[model samples]
Target: MQPGTFELLILIFIFLGLQAWWIIPIINKNNKFNKRGKDLREEIKQLEKLYKK
Candidate 1:
């Protein structure tokens, strides 16, 4: 309610928003990468006999 306090709060939100702009994508990409790796491992497990041949 004080003068300039709202501006500071807005700036903090902007900074957090910018940080999330990259952080969220980075986390999502990391999750996707991990999921893909897990899927590949599962596929390899299912085909392990083929690799031995």
Candidate 2:
């Protein structure tokens, strides 16, 4: 395989992995709120749970 092609593939994978790392948790938090509603205390508790873990 060509070195340039391999490097391009690695770059693409890194970009996608970084995007998921940043976006997935926000999506999950939003989903949690969708299930729990606009409860500030609940969100705070959730954040605490994650921090403890």
List the global CA lDDT of all models.
Answer: 0.96, 0.91
**Which residue pairs clash within candidate 1?**
none
User: On residues 1-53, what C-alpha lDDT tens digit does candidate 2 reach at each position?
Assistant: 86699899999999999999999999999999887775777899899999999
Output the number of the TM-score-best candidate: 1
* TM-score of every candidate relative to the true structure: 0.81, 0.64
lDDT: worst 10-residue window of model 1: 44-53
Candidate no. 1 TM-score? 0.81
RMSD of each: 2.0, 11.3
Error of 1 at 53 (Å): 9.8
Clashes of each: 0, 0
